[model samples]
Target: MTTLYGYYRSSAVYRVRIALNLKGLAYDQAPVNLVKGEQRSEANLARNPQGLVPVLESDEGTPLSQSMAICEYLDERYPEPPLLPADAEGRARVRALAQLVACEIHPLNNLRVLKYLVRELEVDEDAKLAWYRHWIIEGFDALETLLKRELGTGDFCHGDTPTLADICLVPQVFNAERFECNLSAFPTLRRIVDNCNALEPFQKAAPSEQPDAG
Candidate 1:
C-alpha cells in the first residue's frame, strides 16, 4: 500500500494530501509530528535526510520528498483528473504560479525558519508576527495582481478545475489565515480558495480534518 509520512498542519504535507485526494488514491498516513520534533528522529532521518515530512513511499518501497516533486510524480503516475494543464505553455504558467508560493513565499515562513528567527536570532514575538504578516501581504498582493490580470484564470487559479496552482494556493491561504493576515484585499485569491474548498478532495485534505491536527 502507498504510505504518506507527514505532519498535519505543514503546508508541504497539505499539498501532497490534496494531490493524493484529487487523484482518488488510497494511501495510509503515517503522521510525523514536527512540533514535537519527531521529524528529526532516526526513523524519519533514515527516510529523509532533510528531516522533513510529506514523504511518499511507493508501494514498491521507493520514498519521495519535496511537496511539488511529489505532486508532479503523482500526476505523471496517475494522469486521470490531472493536476496540470494540457498544453506546455499552460503547464508552465501553472508551475510558475505554484513556485511563486512554494519557493518564494513558503520557505521564509516555515516552522523551522520561524523557530530559528526567534530562538537563535532573538526576534521578539511582535517582530515574529510582523515578519509573518509582511511575507503574506507581499506575496498575496503579487498573486492577486497575477490572477486578476491573467486570462488563464477561470473558476480556479488556472482554469475551471483545480490545478497545481490551486494546490499550492490553498495551503498558503491556510497559513495566512492562521496568522490572521488581512485577506480583504485579495478578492481573487479568496474566490479561487472558495472554489477549491467546495471540492470534496480539498475539503477532506484540510488541516482541521487531518488525523493529527490539534
Candidate 2:
C-alpha cells in the first residue's frame, strides 16, 4: 500500500493528502510530529533529505518528496481525473496559479521559517506573527488581483472542475485562516476555497480529519 509520512497541520502535507484523495488513491498515513522535531529524525531524513513531512512511498515502494513534484507525479501516473489542463496554454496558466501560492506565499510562512524567526533570530511572538501576516496579506493581495482579473477562473481555479491550482490554493488558505490573517480582501480566493472545501476529497483531507490532528 502507499504510505504518506506527514504532519497533520503541515500545509504541504495537506496538499498531498488532497491530491491523493482527489485521485481516489488509498494510502496509509505515517504521522511525523513536526512540533516534536520528528521531521529531523534519521528515518525522516532518509526518506527526505530535506527533513520534510509528506514523503509519499508509492505502492511499488518508490519514495517521492516535495509536494508539487509528488502532485505532478500523481497526475501523470493516474490520468483519469486530470489535475492539469489538456492544452499547453491552460497547463501553463494552471501551473502559474499553483506556483503563485506554493512558491510566492507558502515558503515564507511555513513552520520551519516561523521557527527560524523565533529561535534563530530571537524574534518575539508578536513580531513573528506580524511577519506571518505581512507575507500572507501581500501574497493574497496579488492572488486576489490575478484571480479576479483572469478570465480562466470558474468554480475552481482553472475551470469548473478542480485543478492543480485549487489543490494548492485550498491548503494555503487553510494556513492563512489558522494564522488569523485578515481575509476580507480576497473574496475570490474565499469563494474558490469554499468550492474546494465542499468536495468530499478536500474535506476528508483536512488537517482536523487526519489521525495525528490532536
User: Cα deviation of 195 in candidate 2 (Å)?
Assistant: 0.5
In model 2, the number of clashes is 0
lDDT per residue for candidate 2 within 8-121, as digits (tens), equals 999999999999999999999999999999999999999998998789986579789989999999998998799998999999999999999899888998888988899899
Clashing residue pairs in candidate 1 are none
Indicate the worst ten consecutive residues by lDDT in candidate 1.
Answer: 53-62
Q: What's model 1's TM-score?
A: 0.98
Give the poorly placed runs of model 2, Cα more than 4 Å off.
Answer: none
lDDT of 1 by residue, 1-214 (tens): 6999998899999999999999999988999999899999999999999998889996568899999999999999999999999999999999999999998889999889999999999999999999999988898899999999999999999989999999999999999999999999999999999999999999999999988889
- Candidates in order, TM-scores: namely 0.98, 0.98
Cα-based RMSD of candidate 2: 0.9
